[model samples]
Target chain A: MPLVYAGVCSHAPGITGRKHLADPGIRDAFYAAFDDMRADLEASGAETVIVIAAEHFANFFMNNMPSFAIGMADFYDGPIEDSDWLGIDKFRAPGNRELSHRLISEIMQTVDVAYAEEWLLDHGIAVPLHFLTPRFDLPVIPVNINCQGPPLTPLHRAWTLGEALRRAADAVPERLAIIGTGGISHWPATPDSGKINVDWDLDFMDRWCRNDRDALLNYDDLTVYADAGQGGFEIRTFLAVSAAAGGAQGTVHFCEPIPIFAVSCTIASYDLGLLDI
Target chain B: MSLYYVQKFLYELNRSADLQAAYVSDRRSVLDGYTLSDEEIGALVDPDIGLLYVLGVNGQILMHFAAFHQIEWHDYLQRMRDGVDEHGPVREGVYAMTGRVGTGECG
Candidate 1:
């Protein structure tokens, strides 16, 4: 049971300064932080990274939307929507089709996952992976958590998906590194969208990293999220991965406020003990 | 229903560089294609940030629309307040103000 690396990431920090990418240690710490994660990932003997990211109304719109989209396609071409800002070649993305199928069936027990074969990774999926590893060869099982549309997936349902993924990973022989990529209180598309609530973001980080589900999920109303920012809902992605990890505690790799994108980007790696494999 | 139309327009604008360019060049023609109400079209073209949000234009779509206009985050939040002052309350969207703006009532 090689469920070695499990954690959450934020993608906003390095977006504005492509220039900082030149000197990985320059303006942002995300580059160096990823370098460290790369070392850890190499040590963990983990092969596939199951990226939990939200889609920005790219694949599904008002006409057709699903709570979840599981990618089982053997091959993936990258970036369906133009993400020229990322500066990565969106031509082809490495994928793990088999594990994706396993996840679809596992997740279907509780939540019906719309199986996707032809779609490519969005910025939510591609940006983090590309930044973490220079080449992006580490196979990924992209889980597009639908956060864009209304009737969005509730926190509980997202947690259910996380729990299912944990069981699926442990039950099988695949060493899956579940990485939830998004959030820590920053709104991407709102008018005050660029403002990151450091206080709220830090509160979430402390509770989430310490596995404080009681405080984390104590919200009776979601306007609390709206108060934080629109992208605040993206944390549902984190909750799913957290549930998958069985509420295990993890190290907070880095949490920084990147005002350029008005999103807090971060990385944390968890070690959930093996399940009688 | 009108908010849905606004959201659709912005959603398309977000993913399409060509559409963004077209929007900036001639918003009137691009907006005319959509069957939006005068209020909806006016809010969009005039760049009424708050009214658009109150009108139920989902934040996901509205934020990018705000950015396209180079609206600062502070100004964007203020615009919503301004909309309350100028355009009445959020007429038919998610942010429709109930009892009072400061009150704990919004449905």
Candidate 2:
């Protein structure tokens, strides 16, 4: 399958309905860009989408966290925390089981990745999907990263995992759309939890838009943690998507600093360079 | 102090309708079941976002708890600010004050 589309979006729950809580202009600008991005995504003519988002200990508790896992089930009843407010009705989505199986087997056997048959579409996956595919009709393949757990997945490994996903997508004979959700910067739960690392967030966005993979991958996990705050680790998902896109550089849809949520919510589109390797 | 029980309490309330009903009808009695400290219970029952934030409950989880209480987004946010002001710089957990809130002042 030719990887037809790739992108990243930051997950800030309040934006779906409670956006009035944020600066009105920032909210309006983000949605305006996001609506345009969604239209482009809809126009991409993709049949199956690969959604890589964080699994916030919702499905697997801290006791049994996996660094990386792909859901193998045919359907999932989306997560609780976000479904309540995001206004997504019949909040379950059918999975692209065949593609998911291909990805799971390919990554597990070849790359030694983990697999899960029971991961609900948590806010990590749902918030972006709510905006990208509002009708819930698109068949999705949900891949998860451990953004909040310890013995953290090294940053480089996340990028390699993206490369693996690219290889997997190369094997399939269909058009694939991939989305990595979460991050720019925000510390969740800390005293500075609402603090946005504006400089850091913008720098990361600029590099990603420019497809500066070398610079992005050069920063070690410790550097990322120190600069971006705890929840900022979600950038691993974004980088993974960038890698999956063959490091194809593209336009940044929007990058708005949402102070209320303390998140630099973003939506960036990429040129999908179909990989043959 | 471990924010474990507080997060656990909020997680159940977020996922289970049964817990929601129990928490509302007999909030203390329901809290009695969890292995929470008195302070945790006090803050939770008060539904004090400030105290909970001060107590080191993760914002991602705490936000849901605030929403369940129908606290507006803006107010839940302000409560966190109020937390630092009243509780005196996050007494425990990951957000412990590293001697003021700026870089180059690192511990």
Candidate 3:
């Protein structure tokens, strides 16, 4: 089956862990957007969800980090954070090792991705799963783009990975959904945690919705750090989804900076029906 | 000033419940494994979040360490600001304070 769904959303721990701290009005609106994303994913008849996330130092550390990695296990357990601290209970999400192996093999044809048999979920994956796959029932294939550490994955390379993922998804018989989760223009996990660049975010989303490859890859990391804070490196995740969308236009479902949540709190996806796939 | 090891220690501790238990039981022994400066050792032992931040530990790792100590979110941010106020600027890493401190929506 061709890739059935492709979208992106925010995955800050504050989105779930600090929900009570945000204004209930904007908070509920943001959550309703998540609900719409879930509805769209379900409506796609997706059998597996491939979550491309800019993970923190959860699984990969500086010791031996891969620019890109995919999970290959029958099951994965997480919030790796203290359940109370993250406000998400501990649960094991199903993984399909067979599906992962095939996908990794296919992705390796184009992108040199490391395959991990063991992975502990952090908020990057956990927060999205809390909404997208609420019951933890769907088989999840986790992909990580090393956006945290310096000497990060280059922007264009992330696009290649996404293209590779789309190829693998289409080659497979089972329907697959791709959801990329990360912040756009916010400083997270620092004293400047709640800072967001609304203009920068809106401009970037404009390029994203237009699926303009040149504009999306035009950003350099130093400028990103200055304009979007260090967290802006996570645009790699979004860029990959755009690459996967294969020229399909997108719609921004929700986007507003909730300082306490530490991001613009966005939810957006491509119109895959526009493609002939 | 072994910021790498300091962050590495926290990275391991944050993900491992067993190491967390061991650290709580005998914090000193946990220090034996990593090559760290006395100041780094003291900061980790004290778990002085602000000092660690000024010492250049990445907030992604440091935040979890703070949470492990039951530090609240706002308190965690304040501790980092206080660290910068007392100890000059962050020594290393990409997470240095950008002087855009009070410009956030939360302010």
Which model is ahead, 2 or 3, in terms of lDDT? 3
Q: Second chain TM-score per prediction?
A: 0.79, 0.84, 0.88
Better of 1 and 3 by TM-score: 3
Highest-lDDT candidate: 3
Model 2: pairs clashing at backbone N, Cα or C within 3 Å: A1-A172, A189-B59
lDDT of each: 0.69, 0.74, 0.91
**For model 2, how does the per-residue alpha-carbon lDDT over B4-86 read when each residue is reduced to its tens digit?**
77877887787788999999898899987678888888898898888887776667677778888888665666777777677
- Candidate 3 residue pairs that clash: none
TM-score of chain A, every prediction, order shown = 0.89, 0.92, 0.99
Which regions of candidate 2 deviate over 4 angstroms?
A22-25, A82-84, A110-112, A188-194, A220-226, A273-277, B91-93, B96-107
- Which CAPRI level is candidate 3? medium
Alpha-carbon DockQ of candidate 2: 0.27
lDDT of 3 by residue, A95-172 (tens): 999999999999999999999999999999999999999999999999999998989999999999999998988888
lDDT for each residue of candidate 3 in B8-83, tens digit (9 for 90 to 100): 9999998778999999999978989999999999999998888898888888889999988999999998888888
**Interface C-alpha RMSD per candidate, 1 decimal:** 7.3, 6.3, 2.8
Give one clash count per candidate, in the order shown.
Answer: 5, 2, 0
Q: Chain A TM-score, candidate 1? A: 0.89
The residue-by-residue lDDT of candidate 1 on A1-277, one tens digit each, is: 6478787877542363243333344335765776787787767777787888887766677878888887787766665444444456665667877778876786778777888887766667766767765576777787877776757787778888888888778766878788888776765543444567778877777878777667667653256445665577788888887787786876788777655545665778665654322
Cα lDDT over the full model 3: 0.91
